[model samples]
Structures are given as structure tokens and as C-alpha cells.
Target: VSQWLKMKGKDPSIVPLLHPPSKEKENVSQLTLEPIYSSFNDWATQFFEEKANGYLACKLCPPSSRTVYGPKTNPSNRSSHVIDKHNLEPPPYLRNRKRVREVKKQKQQTLAETPIFATTEREKQRENIVIVYATNLLSASTLDDPLWRATFGEKLAGMYPQLLKEMTIEYSKNLDKVFFSRAFGPCCLMADGGKDISKHKLLGSCIKANGKIHVHELFNTENEVLDTTWYQKYFSRVITDIESRSNLVVVGITTDNEKSVVAGLKKVVKTNDHLIRIACGPHTMELFLDDLAKNYKPLSEAIKQARNFCVYVRNHKQPLSALKKYQVDVNGNPVKNPLTLVLSNNTRKWSGGFLMISRILRLRSECERLLRNFPDVPRLSWSSLEDARDYLFEFYLQEQILQRDSSNLIHYAFCWRQMGRHKDSIVESLKATNHDTNVLAISQCFVKHQEKMEACRVFDLCCLLWPVPPKTNNHSYFVNATAQLHYLVLRQWKFYQDHADALQLPEEYRGTNENLRLTFLNKAKGQLTMHYEAVELEWRDPQHLFQASQEITEGHLRQTLQPTPNLSVPGISVEDYWRSVACLCPELRFVVRILLACSASEACVERIFSDEGNIHDKIHNRLDPAYSESQVKIKGNFLVERERKLREKDFGFEELEWEEE
Candidate 1:
């Protein structure tokens, strides 16, 4: 190759020998061996990353990739197959005049000289002129808005830096985003007297599109009235800004169960037609505890004790720390939160925030001890605790969670033996009628809360007059009217002739059937009518659920009778069937005549739950996932001294024993 290159007026010394060629005569014999790696133009290139016919055809790998030919390939195998030593493809370029001579000459000369560092006078002047022009055009006042404070924390402190100094920088970072602030639609405001959540205190509203929940957190002040006013101003401003930028509308407002938030939204919307007001169902449910307590004082008192017991276990961690003090189960886990000792799943809320019955029993021993020592610690009285427990026992058995058995008959019997929650619910509703402030709204809530068959007669007539004349009734097809008519039929058919005048079931429908066959058949026809109607619900609807379950039960019973022997059709034992129906549907008892020869057990009903829904469960089974919280240890390793020094009050986390590696 060297001789050939020199003949063509190229560099005589072109190819580099991998090892320095020996000058000794004896080394000439070693040159007889084939090179594992070859070279060109003294350049050290990877043998595996070059293109030439001596290598295999490239697969999916880049074209630059190279390999010696063969199926069994390895790092040590660098041989080109024996047949292809001469039959090869040409490379991209040869060790020639264009590559070696000219390129090498330029590279050597360039490396020998020093690099220039200074810019030309014209270039320097051009950059400085650009900077000066931009400086004069820009205004420093642009930094005054919340935008600057959002991006640059300390450098651009907000107007009220002292007030916001305590809040986290990340919380206020929303102001930095221009895209989010502009070209937006659909903003809703929500406010409540904020409570501290572990590390931070927050006041915010949800402004969103479709289903995206964007939190617009605003600053809050200590002065309660001023705090509310600030939120209102912020909410109103954002709404107006959004409306101007885009054709946006305020659809709904959801607030916590607080009086202040309700009062704030009340200012903007009057009848809830434009701005739909929704309260957190969980919060409204919490208020039920207060109502239940007033109606059945005994149950509330006990629940208080149970809550104190759970809190005490947390406060006095030392007592629960040792394994020997409280024996571990066979699984080596400690007994669950002692709250279960007082509050059973029966009447307990799903979140298990606090229950009256369990609190009483769970706190019994603790209360006695507190009385013996520091009597000043407040707790429920013994008489109140007993009443609370007795009342809650009934609620627990009545609730699907606590009574796991399908035997609503048995569950109801057992629960009723204790006390009925329906009684408390009704009593609470009746008491609201006396309140003059929300006299109308409260009355509406009252009727809905404790619904009864006979009570629904008023709403039936009200439905007839719903759209008066010009507007059509909500009932769309014959199916919808048939559905409503069935409701009317079942109700009218069941009512005693004596009660007919009081109910006023429209004028033509007033007369009672003198013939027993027609009356019974008409009543059966209403039951037999297959009709469907859709209801517009704000959120959760339990009434629909009850109706659905009852429908399925009655349908299945009638279908089962179709194949019976001796009789033309199969039929349920009327007494038992009606009694069982009454047991499940509290509203049906008035017309159904649910008196059973013997009260039915709830076991069948519970088994039926697996088919219908998960409405039946044992006391412990009914407890919400939150109650199981104290059961598991948190995941991930601890962070050394940081986790160790973290006080109990700083965050509601249990202290860990080890540091993360």
C-alpha cells in the first residue's frame, strides 16, 4: 500500500502498523501472521465501527457498525471468513491524496498556532447598543404585580411580605403562570373557616374545566370577617376577569360545612338556580351526629367516650409501645386501635370520625381511671353513655355495614330490639319545623329526610300542578306516565276506603271498588306493571337504591312462581313476602301489611347483598378503611435525624426507629 501510494504521488508512509514494525531481521517471520485489526492513514479507528466488505452486512444497527463474518460471533472472534479474504467491498475512501495529504497538513498547521480571544470593536459596540436600547424600553414597575413575587421569592417579596412570609413558596407559585391566568373559562368559588392540615393552613377555591380541578389558593387573614371579605373580593375579581377574557359562566359552588362559606355564596346567588350550592355530603353527615345526639342523647354521650379513648391511646403512646403490656396476636401484630372496643360498625359513620355508642363503652375503664386520678378531664356521664350505646346498637344493626347478614328480618329484629334510628330521624325532622329562620327550606329537608308513604300524598297533588297549563308535565312517554301511574295505583289501591277522602287521589280516582276481585286485581296490576323512570339527582341518591332493590325482589318472586306444580303459577307466601318486603323498605309498611307470624331473620337478606350490592356486613366488617389506618405501618425508609426529631404535633405521623441508609 505504501509503495502504491508513493507511485501515485501520495504519502509513502500511509497505513499505520498496529504494533511498531520491528527493525530486526528475525521479526520478519512474525509479519507472516494475519492482523486481527488493520489500519489506514495512521488513524486509530474502532474495527467494529467501519464500512467495508470484509465485515458482515449491517442488520438493524447503524451503517457505521462493522463485524467479522460468521453466525457464531463473540468479542474474541475477529476473523473474516476464509473465502472472503479477497472477495471484499471497497471502503468510503482510500488511504489517498484527498484524505491523508491535504487534511493532515491543515490539521498540523492549525494546532501549531495560538487561538484568538478578543472580539472585534464593531461586535463589542453592537452588543452594548442592544442592551442599552432594551434597558430604556423596559419598565421596572412591571415587577409590582404578584407575578414577580411568584417566580423570584426573596428578591420580589409580595406587598404584604410579613403576612405571607409563613406560607410556602410553592403555594404562591400559581401567580407565575401566565398561560393559566389568561384564556380560561368556568371558575367556581368555595370557602370555609380553614382548619390546619398537618404542615400548612390553606384557603382556596376550585376553578376548573371539564373535570380538571385547578386550586386557586388565596391569602387569608386572622380577622374572620375580613378573611371572608378578602376571599369574596378575590373570588369576584377572578370571576369577572375570567368572564372578560372568555365567555365563561359560573356553574356551581361547593363549600365545606361552615356557616361563613354558606353566608358568602348566599350574597351572590338567591334561589340556587344560577349558582348551584352543594355542601360536602361528608360534612352534612357529620352534622347528623349532632342531630342524633339531640334526638337520642344516650347514644351521643357514649360516642364521645369512645372518641376520647382513641385520642388517649394516641396521646399516651407509652402505654401502647411495649409488646408485653398488650399481647400481640399470633400474626405478631398489635391489637387494632382500642376505638373498636367502644364503637362497633353498626351505627359508626363510614369515615369513623367519631361514634357515640363505641366511645362510651371504650372509654369506660379510661374514664374510671381519669376520675380516680385527674377528675378534671372532661368526659361523658355514665347515664348518657348507656343511652348512647343503646341507641347506636340499633343504628349499627339497621345500617347495611354492621348487619352483614342478608336476613334484614333477623337484623331488623335484633336492631329493633335495641332502638330504631328511624324514630330518631323522624323526631329530629319534626323538631326542625319549629325553626323560623329556614322555615321553608328546613321543612323541605324535613320531609325528604324522614320520608313516609302517607306523607308523599301531598307531593303527588303538587306534581299534578307542576307545569300548570302552557308547560307540559315532566312525564315524557306513556312509560313515564305509566310509571307514575303505577306509583299512584299502588298507593291508592292500598289505602283504606275510610282514609280515601283525606288522601284526595284526584277526583275520578276517589271511589273505592265495591267488588273484591277488581280491587285486588287492580292492586296487583299496579304491582305487575313494568315501568321505568329516570330521576335527576344532585349527587348521591339512596331512595333510588331502595326502589331498585325492591323491584328486583318482587320481579324475581313472580318469575319463580311461573313454574310451580298443582297451581297455574308459583306464588310467594303472601304474609312472609310482605313482611320481608316491609323489613327492607321502611316506606312500604303502610300499604304492604308486613306483620309476620314470626319476625324474619336478616341472614337471607345478607346473602342477597352479594347479588344486589355490598349492603350487608358484620360489625367489624362494616368499619371504614380509615379505621384500619392504625393497623398498617407506613412505607419507605426513614430520613435520619429529620424523622427522629419530628415532634408528634408537627405532623400526625408516628415516630420511626431507624434512619434510611
Candidate 2:
């Protein structure tokens, strides 16, 4: 404790002297035998009189013991000296405690006389009120509500401009810092057009990098409908601006598969082979389903009949009442299986058709009953309804799975492969239901797109880089996939071999021979192949038959291929499992990290469009486009910064502990 106090620059040694000795008397003797003085003023004014040199004659001090104490201009100072040195206490009128109390009372009285405007607490209160009022005004927040008006005062209602000006200046400074920061990775830029409340089309671009939305900017499109050339120029400028500001490399761009958008992206990708262009996955899938619904005769007729039936029930009163009547329990309470066709629209999500079909099928018996009662109503064919359900059941389930967000890098590979399986299952089910190939032809169109999606080079690599082995988990196809990956790697090696003179070398190998470069490539390829074969062999030889003599024995391979019992056991995801065994495939880990950062869909940017605030309402139509853009950018970047800081703190602490150990 004493050392701590000394470190704090405190005089720990003087603690004992702070409390004086108890031997000293508590009350001192009165110094004078004169009559009791009324007050210090009365005593000085009556007998001694003040001197010219700011001193007062102390006649009482001389009579008691001491030489005259000259300073009486300040009565307290004189009394303290008399009490401490001369062993004398002051009279009641001149007591130090009473004087202090009177001074405090006077201060309180002065404060009571002051106005509320001059006080610091009231100033702060008013400032807060103005800020809230201004925010409500600028954001088009409901100000007329009695509840809001009662909450924040009616005063300072027009303070929005002042607050907004100050905020804009401060926000600009912060945005500059964010733009210049080199924290983000190579980004995927996504742009799509949306409409404001006034039906004005707004072209918005959002940059997604490092698993966060880094920026979202909106531009008023005016009268120019986005054409192929317009989009090409706009996207190029967007990329250059983002790269210049954030130091981000533009890796990929994603948009819906609109005709104009597809053409625009084609133009951008023509000369930029290093950059990727992705047709928004969910949108592509939605379009495929839309086409299937239109072209497939049985499904089309079934859906049309269902829609007509639903419309008749909704528009006519008798059928609607009957549906409610039929949907009741034994105790007379209404059941909630009320049915509607919910006809799919173009803007509906990918799963909209499936949901609609499922609901119609669920109410099939009820619909049949309703149809029997209405003689004039056209009937829905049972075969058509059954066929449509059978064809769509597997697809509906598959779409549900695909629409979910996958957290792991390996899931991209896993999901696409599962999609292939779902397509096959749908075909087999269709074959069993019908002998004809008419339905099969329609399904193959979607299957072709799925195949194209799986052909993405990075996706193929991710599949090959999956940490586990094939045979034990029933993945024979991966063997061929691995060979294809090896072939791709060899092609790159051959290219580098041919262009050894033109190749940029690492710092350590800048002056090395061409043979050394080939040797390095050969060595790396050998290690990768060895690791691949060892994992495959261990999976095939589950009994450990080849354990004794091999360079990477079956036992070592088993340890690598099998998940750790406590660490990679059940309930752990594939991504987390691969992360745990990252040491096993150190070379693959880097590519996996980069591929994980790449989004498979434009869902992030679509979400940005859907996040329009009240500031975009018609009431606030005159609001500056720059203000809207900055607001979104700040909101998104602030969230990203918060998550990044938290993760850094958590992982950094864990890393420090691991290092110490």
C-alpha cells in the first residue's frame, strides 16, 4: 500500500504527521480581559482604527502576551495566528466556522437569483433537445405525434439546418479517413437500380469486402434508362473510384442476369480476365423456375386452374364463407388453414412458386369439396395437380437449402454439388412418374446452368481442397475432380516454365537460374500430389493394410483424414473442421481464405437496396442524394468497424495466451 502511494507521487511518510498529538488542548484560552467584542468589524472600527498601510492595530494581542499582531485587514488570518501561536481563541462573533457557513449561504442565495439560461446543466439539456428535434425533422420522423412532442419539447423546432451543417462537416472528415484506410481486401462491387417513393429510379452501388459492406452509394438516374453502354461506363468509374479511395482491388462484380446487365458485364470482362463476373445466383435460379413454370404444360395448366379457383373464392362471397366454415374444430373454434393461391409475381423470391404450389396442394381436399358444391366452377385435374407436386417437391426443398447463407468456404463446393444431386433426383422421380422426356427436356435447361456454375475455377479448387478423404464418406467423384485440379495446376506450371524470363520472381529468387524455378515448381507440385494421394489412399484402405512401408503410411493418413474426436466431432461444420486441420494443408489454407471472402451471390447488395430509410420518403424528396449516400455508408462502415474491432480483440487475446504458453 505504501509503495503504491509513493508511486502515485504521494508523501506516504507524512501520514503520521497529518493527525496532530492529542496532548494539545481542544479549546484555547481567550486572549483578552476586555469586554466581549461584537464582531471583527465593530472591534476594529471602535477602538484600534485601521492603519494606512493595510494593517489593523490589535490592542487585545498586546494585553494578553504577544507583541502586536499587525495584520487585521483579513480578520480570519489574525484570529488563526492568535489561536495557533498565542494560545487564544476568537470571540463568538468572529468564529471561523460561523463565517464559513455565512459565506456558503450567500453563495446559495446568489445562485437562486440567477436565470436558468445562464446555467451549464440547462444549456446541455436544451442542446440535447435541439439535436433530437433536428434529427426527427431531417429524417422525416413523425413530429406531430403527441407522444413525441411530449417527449422532446416544442422549442427549437427549426434547428435541423444548424445540426445538419455541423454533422456534415464532421462526417466528411471521418469519411476521408475511412476512404484512405488500407484495411479492406479485394472487393466485389454490386450495382442494381431501385425506385424511390416518388417512382424515380435510383442506381445504387455497394462494395462488399472482408465479409462486410464497406460502402453503399446511390445516384439519381434521372430520365436515362440504364443501357449496356451506360452500365459499362458507370461500373468502370465506380470501380476506379472505390479502388482509388479504399486501396481495394476489384476482383468480381455481381448483378442480376438482366439482358442489359449481362451485356454490360460482358464488355467489362472482355479485357479484364483477372476480374470475375458472376450472374446473381438466386436471380438465375428464380428465372430458371420462372421459365419452367411457363413452358411445362401440366404444371402451367395446374397453376392456372389453382389461381382461377383462388380468385373465384376471394371475389365471390359464398365460397369464401364456405372455406371459413369448413376450417373449424369440434369445439366450434375456427382452425387457421385458410387457403389462398398467392399467385407468383416476377418480383417474388425464388421460393415463391414452391410455396404457392405447396399451399394449393395442402388445401386440395378442401378445394375438391368446394368445387363439388359449385356446379358451374371448372374442376382442377387430379393428375395435373399430382404431377406438378411430384415434379416440384425436390426442387422446392433444394431451393430452400440454396437460399440459406453458408458460413464455410467448403459449403460453396458442398452446396453446388448437392444441387447437382437434387437435379438428378428430380429427373429420376420424373422418370418414375412419366415415361415421356417432355418434362426431362425442361429440367435439363436448369441442370446445364448448374453445371456451368460448378465449372467456376475457384469453385473447382475449393472442392479439391476439401480437407477430408473420399472413399470412407462415399465420394468417388472427387478422385476425378482431384485429377482435373492437378491437370489445371500442371498447365499453370507449364506456362511459367515457358515464360521463365518474363516471370516476376520473389525477392529471394530474383537472380536464380531457370532450372531453380522449375525445380521449385516441381517440388511444390510433388508435395501437393503426395498429400492428395496419401489422403485418398487412407480413405480407400480403411483397414490400414498399407501402413508399414509407405512414405505417408495409412496410419498417418488416417490421423489426417479423420476429424479430431473432441475437436472435429459431430455438430462441427465442415468449414470449422477444415480450419481445425489447417496445419495439414498449409498451402491450401491461403487460397481457401481468399475464396471464402468471395460472395457466391449478390444478396449483400440486394439487402442494401432494401434498407431504404424514412429519409427517402416523398416528404423528404428534396433531401440531397449525397446525404443519403453518406448516411448509408457511415451506418454500414460503423457496423463493420465494430465487428472488426471485437474480433481483433478476441483473437488477439487468444493469440497472446497461445504465444505465452
Candidate 3:
């Protein structure tokens, strides 16, 4: 070939190397000797150069096997096969470039059969951005501005309504899943009413049994007062509607102590005995604080002085800024105040009295100095401040304790016990401050709280059943516990029996007699016994948990009485701890699940009211009340669902111990 090229007057170097077909077959073994390309550029150039002769190679593939792939020209197809078949990350640039080319090619084909105005990829992406931005900020109309068109183009900017509709539909579907799924099932109902920016009445319900916001609706009462009758009928209707839609029973309803709401709740309970009626524990505590303050002269005088002092600072920004500056100067932290006075207001959820007292006590020295610095500041008598803190410190702490995780069921039994202790503390205070006018008022409120706590036999029963900080499973404890459990079961039985009698169901199915009561009690005791045993055994040997024998009760009792903290227990949450130990005590799983679903207070619903104010603020004021409801519901439930997903991913639901024979 070189001799022929020389005779033709062309340089021999210009001639392309051409291997004979027979020689190519001989050289196939040598072709497999090339090293694997580290990147796309090397692989693409080398492969295509070789492909000029209609050959394909895969250096990474075993040479003993077919180390070659295809005469594949499509980079995407080649990269995809390499990744799938060889389990490798294909080069990014080549894969992305190939993907973009394929997409454009498909787009061209699509455009050929469509109108010229068909939305392009860039327009679709811009439309998606606008939709997401609008949905997040609740600012749908912002996209309608002419300024947005310059950046997003008219076609994309104009699609905001469609984008919003799609988002609403997606959000609705998610909410539907939350409502219908067992994961969000059988929740406590927390409902409250608040006005929006336009003073439009909004009533929202948060189902905390499964830690998901199930319903948040706006009531179009149209400038009318929501009286007792309205609340009664509305609550019943809402509960029924939610139950029907979600297929999840409302275990209980919690509300603040408005006389109308209290009376309305009574009506709800009258119709549904299965539904427990609970006054918001936090709200009740707030009332207790108010009653104490009213009855106690010194405390009332102290609060009056504190309120005036706060008013002077708050209404005057200069004084407030001076106070903050004093806090920073004294503490050596300019950016953060050691403590900023939180003005106590009647409307605050955690009573303003508690906040005022807590802050005053914490920063008593600084506050006194600040008062002196600002001569205009109201002089709170030192005796008044000291006397009020002395009298109200216990009450403040109790209120704070009850308010803790008010939306969590795990703390309900604990809160109930704490309330009893608080009553005792109040009684002690009543005696200590015998001359104070507030003593009688505090005593009266304490008596009422004591009676309420005492009436709920189930609260005591739940306390007996709680797993952590183990109880002595003694003969006396068991006997008393059994009696309490029996009382609760019988009450539940009577409730169901009355319902059956009222409905007059088929005679065979309606049999709710002493036998049914006995059966329930027996099951309850058995489950409790097994649960106690399982919890004890779990600490000893979790691996062989199911093998734990009930006959080893005495040994289990001793262990439970003196639970040793291991490396795992401290980090584990109450839910996770129960979830872990539940398998060993399988019969008690459902009982624990129910207890966990209960909320101590209706704070979750109250949180929605605050959220609604933010969502329907001036910038987002045009949001329809219904739309606002949807947004808040999705926001709250999405957070809970996300946590649930992460928990499930880490420690799955499949670990639940099922009931054994």
C-alpha cells in the first residue's frame, strides 16, 4: 500500500491504516488488551475511532468472556446498558448531553404534530417554578404581574391558575391519603375557632391521635355568634363527617372552657359514650392560675405592678430598646438578650401570668436595676415581687408541666397525676397564706380539679399501665389496679350496653351483660399482666423476648422495680421504646397504641389558629378561607407524615409484636 501511494504522488503517512478481514479476526484477541477509559472523552473518541471499522469494545468487561458490547452509536443507550449490566456510574457529561439530545429530538417530533404555541421545556420549567413559589408563599396573584412575564414569558406566567389548580389537586390527594390511611387513623379531635385577617370566622380541627392534621375548615357563620347550640350541632356534625370520611373514630374531643363549648361538648358526649370529653388541660391550668391570682391579694397587686411596668416598656420602644441594651451590656452579648420581657396578655395560650412571673423571677435583679435606670418605669414593690413568686412559683411550674407536649398523648396520664399533686400544693399554699383572699378561690378551683381527676378512674388505670419508670407489681398494687381496671371496663361495657338498648340492634348482637363485662376485665388483666412481664423481660434479653415465660413473674417483678439504664434506653423515645418492647408484650399492643394516641391538651388545634393568621396575613389576604384551610392542613400533616416516614424507614412498623395465642 505504501509503494502504491508513493507512485500515485500521495505521502504514505496520509493513507489510513486498513487491516485485512482475515488479519482483523486474528487481531480480535489483541483488541481486548486496551485499558478501560477513566472518563467519557477518552472512551467516546477511542470507541468511535474503532467503530469506524464497525467494532465495539468494553475494556472493563472480562476478556475471557465477550468483552465487547455493540455497534451502539446512541450514547444514552450505551451508558444505560453499561450502568445496568455492569453496575457502574456512567460518565455524567456524555450521559446528560445524550439525554438532552434525545429529549430535544422527541420534542421536535412532538412539535411537528402540534401548534406553534405549544409550551417548550423552558416555559414548562418556568411555569413549574412559578407554581411552586406561589404554593409555598400562598402568593398566587404575584405571578400575574407584568414584570414576571419578562423573565418567565407570557405563556408560563399566564398558567398560574392552572398551576394553582394542579397544586390544590395534589394537596387534596395527599390529605385524602392522610384521612383514609390507617397510618393517620383513630385520632383525638382538637377544634377551635379564630377570626382571619378580615375578621372572618375560621374553625379548624386537628386530629392528633395519629399525629396528622386531618381537618382544618373555615366556618362561614357570616358575622353571627357561635353559641352553645351552634357549637353542639357543629361539633357533632364535624366529628361525624370526619369519622365517615376518614374511617377513623374520634376517640375524644378537647376544647377550652368557654361555657358554650363546655355545654356543647356535653351534648356530644350524651350521644356518643365512646367519645371521651376532655377539657383542655393547659387551659384549665391557666384558669387555676387566674383564680389563684384573683384570690391572693399580694400576688394580684404584684401582677398589677408588673403589668404597668411592662406597659411602660412595651408601648415605648425607646425604653424597651434601653432594657434590651441593658440586658446585652450586663450579659456581654449584643446580638441576643439574656431575657426579653414577654408581655403577658389574656389571649396568650401559655398564660401571660406564668410568663410574667417566670421572667420577673429569672431576671429579678436586672429588672429592678432596669426599673431604677428608667425612672419613669413603674416601681414594683420588692415585697410584692418576692411574695408573688413565693406564692405562685409552684402554680407556674405546674402550668408549664401540663403545657409541655400538650398535643402528645404520652404525657396525659403523667399530667393527671401532676394535677393531683398541684391540688395538694395549692391546698398547702391555702393553709400557708391563710389570710390571703385568694386562698379561698384557689381552694375552690383545686377542689373542682381534684374531683374531676378523681372521677376519671381510667386516668388511674392508665397510670397503672404505663411501662416506663416501672411500678411494683405487688399483690396489693395488682389488687387495687385490677379493681380500677375492672371499674373502667364495666363503665365502657355499660356505655356500649346503653347504646345498644337505645339503638335496639338485633337481640343476638345486642347482648351486653355481666358476662361481657367479665370478659373485658379478664382480657384487660391478662394483657396488663403480659405487658408488665414483657417489659421486664425486654431489659434482660430482647433477642429471646418472646420466649419469656409468664410463670417467671416474681423474677420479672424484681427486675422492673430496679430497672437499670443501659446504653440504648436513654436515647430511645417513648414511642420507640414502646414500639420496641411491644412485640414481647403483643397482647398489650393495641392498648398501648390507643394510649399513645391520646392528647393531654388541645394545643395542636390552637397552633393552627396562629398558623392561619400567618397564612392569611396581608400579603396572602386574597387566599380564600377554604384555600387557607387546605394550605395549613397540608403543612401540618406533611411535617408529621415526614417524621413518620423517617421513623418507619429507620425502625419499621413491621417490628410490631402481634398477639400470640
Candidate 4:
């Protein structure tokens, strides 16, 4: 090949290309010459040459600063040295190479146009998966799981933070539209706090408006000391912010019987005269039970014995097994999943003390049989347990009634009166049984708490507006409550009337209509006075009240005071009743709406905290506090809307009775 190339007057280097070595020999030759060929090719060959020792020395570089590439060095090293040292343009082939960024852009565009990478449906699926993950408390890392990836595809995985942000914004907007509508009116603020499994102290707040409770804000108060001053300041700011954001007027605040919270609320009420502070009725009743257990020796001893018995059975496997084995029905058939003893914890609001006693009472036969083998267990005082159980059962019913979201001051008053009657009956029963000390102690406890509850003027006023006349025989108390009701109604009416009148007139004409407004106000007062007289008269006579329903006629006083059907039924809604009568008594309806909207207990806020605990559980302990709170708020508002929709869908018919008077 070299001899032929010489005859043709061409360089001998072309001889290798024209007559390449055989396949085996060519592989070896290419491997040996690859480094030399690559280093000298294109741009590098312009300014460098390979030496005997297999180094490519740069020609353009100064002698002292000459750069070289070893045999094992990459071709990029030679090319970089030539271009950088000489500041010369790269060869055509090198210059035409695609850049890293342009290559990446092309790949992305190609992928975007692919069928699998289509976004519309995939994006929706991803959004739904994120919502399910959030609402169901699924772990964010589950997105990366092998099974999840295989089922949902790899495209749906990751991006948790970004997806969560979008969902949070969307749910926040939904919550705003649902809970904070422009028709916002009077609402009560409820606040409570507790520690989650993570030991993070959380304070939750809720607003009750239009007979539904809406979660407002949740704060991580781990660093703040929970004291009267802190609560006062915190609640004050919350109230101010809420009022500023909407047309809602916070007419009252309800909270559990925490000393600092109560003291703080008192301070808030002092500053804001229109606001009333209500102690949670259920919490108060729990305290009442606490008092009874402390003051009554017999009841206290019985409860302690019952608690010890429960602990013994639960801790000792032998007794528990025996009790379960012996558990049977009245027909002597074996039962599956036998009842277990419920241990009472003081930290829990329900106390479960009554539940504990009740369980033991239920498994009495089984317990008695188990006691034969396990004599070391403490014996229960059956009579004393029965007495305590029966007494606490009444309070239990009252607590359940009061804890309802629909419960209001009127319900509180009725429960209070019912408890008073139950207490008296127990005292009389104890007197007949010759238990003098027990009777005296029970009487004192009832009177003390009763006085405390009645001290709040709002309770009495709400009771006076109860659809059914209060069953008290104390005519003097009734007279005083009636007077207070009239005064409160008139005051609220004036405020509402003045606000309405001002809004109706222009700013320039408001001052000039003062005389005309006074005249209108006087006429309205006369009508309100007549309605008050009719309400009071009907309240004193139940027969007359029901009879007046039959005499309804236009422009008649009976029409104004017509008794609503099923008004005394326990299931009847006070808010609904007042709404039914709104046309007949707008002033009365206005006052009742505000009072009824004031929650009687902080159960709704307690429920919010419970949900937060579930969301921020051990598995999700590392969740961001703000994220967890948003989840709880969104979940709660969704439930509220769902319940409202359900209530709207529920319809019923009732038979109406009329009397020919």
C-alpha cells in the first residue's frame, strides 16, 4: 500500500485508509492508535502535535507554560488546551455539536408530545391522589412506594410539596366561600387547647354561626405559657381579626372550665360589653359530678372500689379470661366478644366513671363468679354502685344534651332545671331511706352550683324565652325574668332599629331624620310592648297558649303569639322555631337568634382538636403544623356543609290538630 501511494504522489498516511489491516489486526491497530488519532483530530490537530512519549504538546502555548496530554488523558483535555490557550475558534464539527441546554430542551419537548406524557387527565388524577393522601392521612412517602408507583404510574409520584400547596390554596378558597359568606351575622367564639402525641400544645378556635360551627384557626402554642394574660390577648386579637374580616359580630365566648381561660374571658368581656362569657355547660356538669364524688363519702368510696376492681380485672389476665369465659346471655348462651371493663381516666372529660360502674353492673354475674377464684380482687359495693350509677346517669343525659351543637342557653336552662328536680327527688328518696347526711350534702351541692349557674343573667333571660313556660312555681322569679327579658329585647331592638334606620338614610339625611326616627321607634316600642304582654300572659297559662293557636287571624294579637306546633318536642330545633315566627316578631326573633347562636358549650372546638390529634398522629408527627391545621379546617368545613345538605334533604310530614274553641 505504501509503494502504490508513493507512485500516486499521495501521503503514506492515506495508505492505512485505502488498504486497512485484516479484522483481527484492525481491532488491535485501532485500539493502539485511538488516543493518538483522537488527540490530533479536528481543532486539537491545528495547534498541537503528538510526541514519542505519547504526550500531545501544545504549539501555541509558551515554552515555559506549554500544556500537554498524556496517552491515557481524554481528548477533551487536548481540545480545551488548544481553544483556551490560543483563544481560537473551534473546528466546524466541534462548533456544530449541540449544547447541553439545547439537548435537554429538545428531549423535554419530545417527551411532552408523547402519549404517555399527556397532561390533562394525568394532572387531574395526580390532584385527586394528593387530596386522598391528605384527607385520608396517608403518608406522603407512599407516593414513592413500589406498589403505588406500579398501580398509579411513576408520573404520579413525588411533587408532594407542590401538590400540597395547590390543594391548600384550593381548599382555603372553598372554606372561605362556604363558611365566611357575605351574609355573615352574629356568632360566638369557642376556644380550647390540648397536647397532641407529639407533645405540641395546640390551641383551636371555632365560630358558631347560623346554628353551625365552623373551624376558624389553629395555633401551635408550644412556646407560649398558657396563662390568663396570654389567653386574654390571644382571644382579643382573634375577635378583632374576625370582626375586621367579616360582618360577624361576636356576641359571646364559650370555653371549658379552665381557670386561666375563664379569667381571661372575663377580662375580654369587661372590655367588650356586648360580649358575654359562657362556661361550657358540660364542663360545669362534669365539675358538679366531681364535687359529688368528693363531698359524698359513700359515693366516693364506691367509685374507688369499682375503679380498683376494673384495674384488677384488666391487669390480671386470669380474672379477665375467667370473666370473658363466664360471660353469658339471659338464655345461658355463650356470647362472642364479651364486654370488657372500662377503666376511668381523670384526664378525659367524660370521666368514664359511670361507664366503668355500668359495665361492672352489666357483668355482675360474671364478676361474681370470677371473684370466687380471684379472691384477692376488691369486692364492689353493689348498692352504693347502683345508687351512684343512677344519680350520675341523670347528669350523663344532661351532658349529652348540652354537648349537642344545637344546644343553646335555653337548653342549658332546661337541663339545669331538670337536674335541680332530679336532685330534690334523690334527696327525698334518701330522706325516706333515712340517709340524712347524704341528703344534706346532696342538697348543699345542688344549691351551690345552681346559684352559680343562675348568677349569669343570660341564662334566666334565655329561659324566659323558652317556647314552653318554665315549670317553676316561684311566680316572683318568673316576674323578675319576664322584666329582664323585656328590658333586653327592647335594648337589642333599639340598637338594631337605629342601625337599620341609619343605613336606610344617606349620611346627609341621617341627622335630619332624628325626629322621624324617634316617632317610628316609639310606634315600634308600643307594638313590642303589646307582644311582650301577650307572651307573658301565654307563658303564665299553658292552656291559653295552646288555645291561642286556633284563633290565628290577620292583625290579631293571637296571630302574633300563635304557638308553633311541636314546640315542646325534645327534637324540635329552637333556631327553626324562632325562624318560623320571624315574620310575626322580628324584634323578638332578632334577639333570640343572637342568643341561640351563642353556643352553650365548647364541644365543637373540642371536636376540632380531636380531629387535629388524629391528623397529627404518630405516623404524621413530622407534618407541618400549618399543613395539619389546614387539613383539619378543610375536613371540618366539608363535614359541616355535608351535614347542612343532609338536613336540607331530610323532609317529614306531621299531622296538625285544631280545636274548635
Q: Which candidate ranks first by lDDT, i.e. highest?
A: 4
Which tens-of-lDDT digit does each residue in 1-661 have in candidate 1?
Answer: 5566788998755444534566664453365543333323122233334335444432323458433444345422332221143333324353353367678888756542312111556434422321121111111111211222222223222322322223323333433243255423333333433333232234534343322233344444444454445545655665565556454455445565456556656664443323444444334433544454445433444565655544554445443242123444558666565433333333444224234344444446644654455444445567655543443443543252132322122222223323332554544554554422332443343343322211122222212211111112332221122122222322333332333343332443345333322343334333322221222121023333323333334344434323221212233233333433432333343223211211223343333233443221110111222322222122112222222344322433332322110
User: Model 3: runs farther than 4 Å from truth?
Assistant: 1-174, 181-185, 328-331, 334-337, 341-350, 395-399, 402-419, 422-434, 453-661
Ten residues in sequence with the least summed lDDT for candidate 3:
134-143
lDDT of 4 at 389: 66
Kindly indicate the candidate among 1 and 2 with the higher TM-score.
2
* 1 versus 4: better lDDT goes to: 4
lDDT of 1 at 638: 28
- lDDT per model vs. reference: 0.35, 0.47, 0.47, 0.51
Candidate 3 TM-score, true structure as reference: 0.47
Kindly list the per-residue Cα lDDT of model 4 for residues 497-556, writing each as its tens digit: 344342232343233233433343344433433444345434434333322321322224
Candidate 2 regions exceeding 4 Å error are 1-182, 306-351, 363-382, 393-416, 422-440, 455-661
Can you give the TM-score per candidate against the true fold?
A: 0.33, 0.43, 0.47, 0.45
Model 1 worst lDDT window (10 residues):
133-142
Better of 3 and 4 by lDDT: 4
